[model samples]
Target chain A: MSSTEAQVKEKKRGRAFSHFKSLVMMQLKDKLDLSFLTSTKQLIAKVVFFVLRIAAIIVAAYYIFYYSAFFSIFAIIAWVPPIVMALAFSIIFILSVLSCMVGLMKTLFFADDNRVLVTMPVTGNMVFFSKLVVYYLFELMRSYTFTFPLFIAYGMVSHLSVGMYFWMAFVLIFVSALPVAIGALLAIPAMFVYQFLKKYEPVKVTLFVLVVGAVIALIVELIMLIPENINFINDWPLKYRPSVISFIESAKTYILPLYAITEMLIGTYENLTFTLKPSNALVFLYVLVTIAVVLGIVYLIAKPLFLKMTAQPFEFEKKEFIKAKENRKRRKYKSILRKEFLLNLRSSISYSFLAVYIAVPILILLLNKIYAAMSTNILGNYMIYAFNLLIILLILLSSNGIVSTMYSMEGRAGYMKKTKPLDMTFPLLCKIFYNSLFSLISIIVSIGIFGAFNSSSIGVGGLIMLALTVLFFHIGHMVWSAERDIMNPQNEQYATTGGEINNPNSNFMTVMAFLVSFAVAFFSFILFNESGVNPITACLKLMIIAMAFAAMRIYLFIIKVRLYYREKM
Target chain B: MRKSVVLTICVIYILSIVLVGYLGIKLAIFDPILYVQSIELIDDPYSDSYKISHPPRYPDQDFVVKEYSKGLKFRLYCKVMPENATNKEVEFIVNMPDNAVGKLQITSDGEVSVLSDDFDILYAKVYILSKDGQKARSRDFTVQINNFKNPT
Candidate 1:
């Protein structure tokens, strides 16, 4: 407790605070990603996307209110607000826990900047605590951005008091801390499992594929669980109906920070008094204490473990050295193709999409079961076929984003290709070749499964037509996307930012994916259901359209890529 | 390996074309409503009477038996079939014989009604016809109305 010792301690504390501030600012800038706002075109696109996202949340709320009323899931229509709120809160909390868990694990343990941060003049614990603080702010920002729309929707629907609205905002700010704490605990076991998986590539990739597939399937199943045309809606077969209310009420208490929030908000807003209920105040205290205990344990364990893990050199270097000793060589095209395929196999953008593509056929079969269970007899064979096509195309085209970013992801290698005497078009074509192959196989399998199961209703002819149409469209879309990137490569941006830059090409492709799928499905379904037009004919028309687009993309890329490459060089 | 993939894809493409063309021969226009497969006259399980879902196509066929002693109005549902058939809409008609004893009427949906609770046994021929002119008549059309009370 000498004066000099106290002064040194205070100076270190100040230094840690400064480090925490700087780290948080950097993280926020990266996360906010308002680079797109500087350009008018990107700003407009982003605004539209933001508006659409908010509208989607509101629309989802609208459906739950009406759909519940329609099904008489609630005894009275007046109960719609509570049901929507409870469901929204529980779902939001669950989703945040998952997102925060993965994000925290990566940010806390695996951020590339960690090595540099550790070597700084600050103490190890300062770096550890600073990272935790920075990440807490990150989780807070993310939760707010995502949940803000939900708050608006909930408030508008419930007509809440200003006090209650402010309560919601306050809860959002600290709510993410609980997940980060829980995720920190969960990350312990998860990291060990991850380390184990990394040792075995095939096992890891298989598990990765299944996990992605299962997540998508789970979402689809949740959507399908809603009663489509339940006749007994107004007079639902219920002994279980009253219990839905009880279930939701019970769920509200179990929904974590939301429950605490509800307790605090209800206590404050009563009779316009600022006083808190003793029991409600206890719940808030419980949340705060739980967060503190978790952080203490993480500090006791994760902080030291993280420092040790960072200090060790990366484990992959030795294996890479052994591979280099093997001295494998191949032709230019073969080597380039192998490199592309290897990147995919190692779970790049292509790999993730590949997993989804492979899972899609199975998903189609599962969705078809639900469709059959719900009695698709109301729709025609052609209509059923059209729907199946829509599901397949939506998944396939959305993955075209992988193709759009392929050139830019090459980093320095992309520019180096221009310096060499490589055939620019050939290499670009090779990039999409594997994807096209993988996509075609998946699309065919999807068509086959849909056709086989519904053969009694939908003819095999529709299946073939759908297969051709989507395949052509998939290839054409890939080419078009790749062409866009080739003409205006973002390799420098990706290199500088470590591939965390705002990629307009990828975003545009995703938006276009949704619009194109809907248009194709809607138009073709209309045609097929029209009298005197066979499914084959309707699909034949779609096939021609897909082929024409593909042909145009192929021709343009062939002629334009070289010219663009020369102009850029 | 790349050549092999290209080869396999080409082969599959050719096969798909041939297969589609072959299977597509059965691809006709909208599956037409062929016939009234079953014109079932069954009581509703959920209720004693069934509410008709569509407007009466044969409005003239819907008649009340005037000059009767009691209310005997009852609706009978006609279940049309060939589930994939387009426009399964049906109309009902009563082909009354001159020798029939009791006054009877049928609605477009095959509802059988007579105002009298006490009438001599009536044998009325009821037919269900689709838009394509295909007909199906219920063989169990005789009503023993001698001591019958109005159920509806």
Candidate 2:
């Protein structure tokens, strides 16, 4: 071979190696970016934050476990709903986090970047692998945040071994990612159904039928529990033995991956005398089938659907009269609010995410009722109190997307508002009001449902407590908005600018909001008791307080809006 | 379309109220309680004997016997407490029913003794004496049972 030809070949090889290295580096960098530890400072801060959080959780767990007898009595009287609720919430937490990841992935993968990526020298496999790696890392970080403390608490209380801890860590990672994988795989078919439904009005009727069918099924299950024939299942021991054992076996086999990890950690076969059994083989089968199905669907269906969704142009059908009217005033504030609401409501991902959130609490409530009915004891007021707390937390969390998107949703259209003839205060108030209204409605609906089922137990006082809590929360959210300077609109058109900027004061604002809201609620309770007022009267007082706070928030919002409007974009 | 959606929601709200009312009425009308009467205790060489009976006022109440002889076991009478009694507190008055002739031993606040001949109380623990003079039979009539030996 000629020396020139050899040199050209060597250069080509060198170019190929460099390309591979760059690809690997890009993948690693993307993975790191998605993690909580994006930088040295972030890593240090997160570690410190997590250490403090974990220590607090450990202390709490120690107290609960060491003083188990007292809590046990409460647990017994309350029908163990809190423990069940904790478990349920953990499941929902996992699912919700995964849904968010899926939403993020869908947003990123389906965006205009796909057009550029498709024409790159990169193979389709390479692109999918890169996305998957990033998604997996994202899920891992999220799961760690939510579940690490829980596992640590569990281990400390249970006195689990080092092997057990390792297994737990493995199971947690896999189980957390399982939901996202499953949801994404399922979305392919869901999307197809959605497309089919989009063509016809019968989709609404079909959904109604499905909901009715579900309710009917629930009613049937409730009826079955009350039947004389089924009473033996709760009563007879000898007859129930096989069924109970088999049910546990089935749970270990098919449900949560934790079962397999637990068996492995505990050394199931070694504890045969204690009635501990091994079902790892069965679990492996279950996991295998699940992975196979998910991967197959992703490869065969998801890729095609994703491509189709991206390839298709978004068709906007506008009513001519409405469009003309909208153009006449060019009320940018109204337009922004409209866009935000529509985006949330129209997006399939958001709707599904909301559905999961709503369904989970309702399911937990129903399950609790069933358990309480079957047992000798009744669920108590404290259980209801905790449920209210959970509902409030959920409401707060759900508002995150809305609040985070508030400034970003403005796009370039917000620039017009700054240059408009109208005062900036008007537009800002309108934006805050729109968000507040949505938040208020959700809170009201959730509280109303809780009130309906638990009216006799929760009483008018509970309703008042909820109302007051909601009111304070709304004001607090607005305060957060102002203090965080979340109103300075950012254009999200460029990918690089999408990263969240750390405002050190955001933490201080969060703490202040929590402390202030909690103090007010606690003080109200004390006053209600000190005055010897009846619950209804106390509730009335709370409602008055809530109204006062709401009024104050409105005034503050007006002032902030004017100030923000005067500031440059 | 928006107006119709709003109207539909209003209609659903009205229906929910009516439905809840109807269900409440139905539950009140069909109030069901399990029935329990007198408990019979059989005397055996292997086991002791005891009996518990309720007045006819609680006709619908039933008792299901659960014997945990080795641990905490007692004859549980599963009737609802009186309406006036707070759920947090229970006050019981025990009396010896007719037909049984024996000096009953009474225990209150962990203090045990035979019922005083001078005082006749509605609530007392009845204890039957054995031939050997060692205490053999006892029943806690007024006290909540923490643990008991099953004589089934």
Candidate 3:
């Protein structure tokens, strides 16, 4: 009521608004600007990638909506709208939260300007608040992209009103907030744990990756087993797994907050269209209050802890270099290969790439197990197609992009590679060899896992053909990426707003090349192998094709290396 | 320029998905799926008597033969292809329980029947072959019966 107090409040509001705006601008400039694309190739790749991603989302939405309508007729008879919506919304919510958690971690503790912000006249709370605001904006875009199609599909199916559409839009904005808050809460502790284990970086990274991979495998196993178990629930002889059923029941109870939102949405629409269900409105109020209280609690807890947690740097003791005896006598190329491996292991990003290398095959193997389980009846005829497809997918996906950014990852240190007193193409060969180790390991593991579990044998001859196919691809892809990077390397030390590095061109080319290769491999397999030809003969022909491709890539890569030297001179 | 491109992509993506989704809805609602619904055993008293007298439940409920019927008579259920499409070639191959006595028959109108002389819980598999490349096979259907030997 006092003019003086009003002015003070107004200034504070103005200051906060300005801070959020500035922070958002900073993020856009540093991390999200399209100018970071640099070249036309990268720009085109980004555009294509964007289109493909949208297409996938559209396809997924179409299937979900189609199936939902099919089941909704029965669901409506059962009057299970609330429960159905809850499960759907919760699954999507959980997935979104998991995805956003890494981004939250980047924003909260690892932002590039954190050190400067701490020393500024502004309070830590202000800085934290600004960061969260920026994070919310990002989450909003992501949440909209995912949820909008679902909403459209649902609306088209359910024949909802214009008012409901507006209400749904309003509700969608806050849908991501719960997930983001949860991610922040989890990520902070994870950061602390990461800092604690910083001393044994290599071992820690390995363990972390293994642990994550195992968790993924376990989740997948559960997903595969749950449907089968549920199917057997009514069979007296095949008694339902009570433990899993109970765990699912408990999980439903725990996800009540998400259930509440779903209930409110459905209830609001129902109340408008049909009878006045007082319980629906009551549930809506309850859910709103719960969300507000939970958010308040999170804010209160995270405010002070954010500064302290972010300030604590990861510490590792320095060690003096000591000359060690040669472990083994190795050739020059082998030594170069070892060096490349060592460099990749030292950096977190490169190590993450390695983790992908190890994790992909295991993931594929688990999936193959599920695939094998599903096709128990049609195993004899289907095995041939499945095996070839699996091998191609695994080799193509695993070996892809790992070596694309190999030289770019060196940043300024690429000059060292250029000036090295050795054959230029030898280093590139070493890089390819290093990548092949991963590809070969993946292929062997996949073959072993599939062979051990499935009744059908991928014969020795088939294995040899598969190996040759994979080897050619791995070599061909690695050379392609290395050549691309050598021709137009991303040597700049570019840092995003969140202390993340982005090698736009190399990363783009890497992914684009892999996708193109995958598409070609897929169609080629479908054409040559699936045309009623004998599978062995088909595979041999495919191997010959791959070999020719590999030979061409190898020749081109050598030419690129020679061109690079000539240009430098 | 960038924003327009993004907008175009988003528009194209949404339209394509909607189109496909609409098509999917139509398919799910209207497409007639050919499948074997169920198999049944015709009741005969002698077969029931024999099965009840036997202690070990050799023929489980799924394959149980309650009556001693001389021959197996099971109805075939299929959703035919589109009405306009004529001359749809359909064939049925039955693997009879007693390979020696069982015979396969297809009427002019594409009716399939299996005739057998003697049956003591006979298991037969019905395989459907169609010209349109659409196939459906029934699970092993069991028939329980024995032709009574009079005064032998």
Candidate 4:
């Protein structure tokens, strides 16, 4: 080979190794970075704050463990079923990482970022690795937040040996990595399919991927709940030891890396003086085979598809233009409402996220039903109420992001409203109307699902409660957007970088909005009962009150927008 | 930076001392030695054996000896009842601390009553009386007792 070509090969090799090292460093840096403690004074303050928080948690945990009988009962009751469920979910969760990759690939490669990256000298693998890292980081954050506490509690309660502690730590780290590896394996095929199927043909491909994904999820759920249904299966082999063995074996296969790390930590090999039986091997083998088959199928489908799709040239066809003549001009409110609804429908990502948010409550309710069937005493009406309350809280907490992002989503394109001859109130009204509508939809869907399960006075009460919550959140959003001056409004399209912001009024406004909403909900509940009204009637009254609040909010928005229009950027 | 380091070290030291003092107090207060004592059962002369039923009339009513010891111990008991009784099995159980290891002994008055090999006695001793009456009175006794050890 020519010296230049040889040099190119050597550079390529070095680049690959450097990229690997950077990825590892990035993950390590994320964990170790203490930049949040910049100044000495700030560091001290943060240390004190963190110490207090940790101490509070420790004190609470101590009280729960030592002082509370209720906590003891709760711990015992929660341990087996919830832990098993969590474990099963984790396994399924591992598999779902692949589906997430498929979803991400569809979003990223077809997204605006792909256009920017495609022209660069970077190879497909580099872009792929970067996206994989991002997705993995997201998964890690979520998994650790939810699961690590439980694991730590388990260790402390069990008084685990040093070996066990090390094993658990290793398993945690391995488990975190497992999802990423699975995501990579899943994404490669997905990207290939995306490459092959351009021009909405990929929709079918994506749907197929999703269907397979859903089926795998369903299977995992079934497997996780298999022990609960052990009595139902009549087969002799499955009736006794084999079923348990098979389940464990399957668990081990997908999570062998985790198991390996755990075993190492626990000194499983050294401790096993007696005959130690390993059961999950077959299940593990099945998972491996399934992964291989799926990969093969994706590759076979993708190679031909990528070349064909990429070769195709972009074309735009002109159609005969006909414009509908304006009838009697509709009311501005109706026009604004229509425009808001259309905007949401046009943005696929927003619509999809909204759809998922709506669907989640219903899915939870269905799962509750299944749980009730399996164990009626454990999953009862009280759980239903708690779940509804949780959903309401989530919707309320999430409203800020959804609504604030709506303002940000406007981008520079929304600046034209300033030049328009229309009243400043029109655009402001439009934004608030759209945001409220979406929030209303989410609230209604969640409450509707909650109501479906409960279907009682309490359910009606909960619906009323949530309606008030949604209204409060909506009003809060209106006040926030109106007051908080946006510098480089285009940056809103991106996710918020820091938890804090420059606007002094923003925090005060949010706090006030939340307190007012809470008070409104509380008073409405009290007044309804005091008046001796039926729950439905009470809810209707609350809804009317909420709408009145929305109306007041719109009035405030109009004033704010006028001020905003006059104010310097 | 030096002040911060010193402060951090001092804080850690204070915390360590507090933790150790607290733990020391806890250990002293909850010391197993304070609570550990021999559980004594006073012998009652009023206690007498009576045959309630032949084929185990009540599930809860078992011929149980009160307390038993740890290892290498035996208690011989003789019992006499009606001749027509078909059940000849005597149940022996031992109640001790979770860590205690022990064995039990029951000697019948005649060949009518026998100890079952299958019984795994850990908590209580049960004796089944057979109706081979040779006029024998059964008095329960325990030997080689050990102090109950706390697992913690």
**For this target, which candidate reaches the highest TM-score against the unseen true structure?**
1
- Clashing pairs for predicted structure model 3, backbone only: B44-B67, B47-B67, B47-B68, B48-B66, B69-B145
Off by over 4 Å in 1: A1-20, A26-77, A80-87, A142-162, A166-174, A209-229, A235-261, A267-276, A310-339, A355-391, A415-427, A449-458, A487-533, A544-552, A555-569, B1-152
Model 1 is docked with a DockQ of 0.01
Residue pairs that clash (backbone atoms under 3 angstroms), model 2: B34-B62, B35-B60, B35-B61, B35-B62, B36-B61, B36-B62, B94-B122, B94-B123, B95-B122
DockQ-wise, the better of 2 and 4 is 4
Better of 2 and 4 by TM-score: 4
In model 2 chain B, the worst 10-residue window by lDDT is: B38-47
A530-567 per-residue lDDT for model 1 (tens digits) = 73434567767888998998899899998898788777
Better of 2 and 3 by lDDT: 3
Query: What i-RMS does each candidate reach, in Å?
Result: 16.8, 15.5, 18.4, 21.0
Expressed between 0 and 1, the share of native interface contacts present in candidate 1 is 0.00
lDDT of 3 by residue, B1-152 (tens): 12342354345334433332333222224335433332222232111221212225554433323333433342333333332223234454555555445354534222334464443333444444555554433333333333444122
What is the C-alpha lDDT profile of model 3 across A1-569, one tens digit per residue?
A: 89999999999989977876776676667567668379998899888987787667757766666664553322311122334456767888887777656776767766657766666556677778777666677778776676655655555555556666666677667665667667766666666776667656777869887888788778667645633212221232124323433444566688887766765554433311312257656765665665577657657876667686567663543454668977886786777878878866666655555655555556555445444433232223333344434444433443355456666666666777766667788886776565567767766665555455543444567556756766676667767877877777766652112233454544665455546445654555464435453456656776787798789999999887988787896
Per-prediction DockQ scores? 0.01, 0.02, 0.02, 0.03
Q: In candidate 4, what are the lDDT values of residues A1-569, reduced to their tens digit?
A: 99999999999999877875565455446545667656898788878986675555545544444432222232211112122233444565666576667755564444444444444565555544555556656667555554444444444443445555444454454455455556655665677666566545658668867975696577546634634322221332224434543455466567555454333323332111111225333333444565566545544554334333333443543444669867767676676667777776576545534544554444444444443333222123333333334334333443344344445456555665677556766665565565556656766766675565556545566576655755565565555545343322533333344222333333444444445544654555454545452455555555576667667765666676677677943
lDDT (tens digit, per residue) of candidate 1 on B1-152: 12332344345334433333344224335444456566544443222344322225534332222223455455455455543334456666666678655677765644556644434445455555666455554443333234334343
Off by over 4 Å in 2: A1-25, A34-115, A118-120, A129-267, A271-412, A418-425, A435-512, A533-553, A556-569, B1-152
Task: Provide the global lDDT of candidate 3 against the true structure.
Answer: 0.56
Q: Model 2 shows how many backbone clashes?
A: 9
Q: How would you class the docking of model 3?
A: incorrect
Best-to-worst ranking by DockQ: 4, 2, 3, 1
The lDDT values for all models are 0.65, 0.47, 0.56, 0.46
How far in Å is the alpha carbon of A70 misplaced in model 4?
10
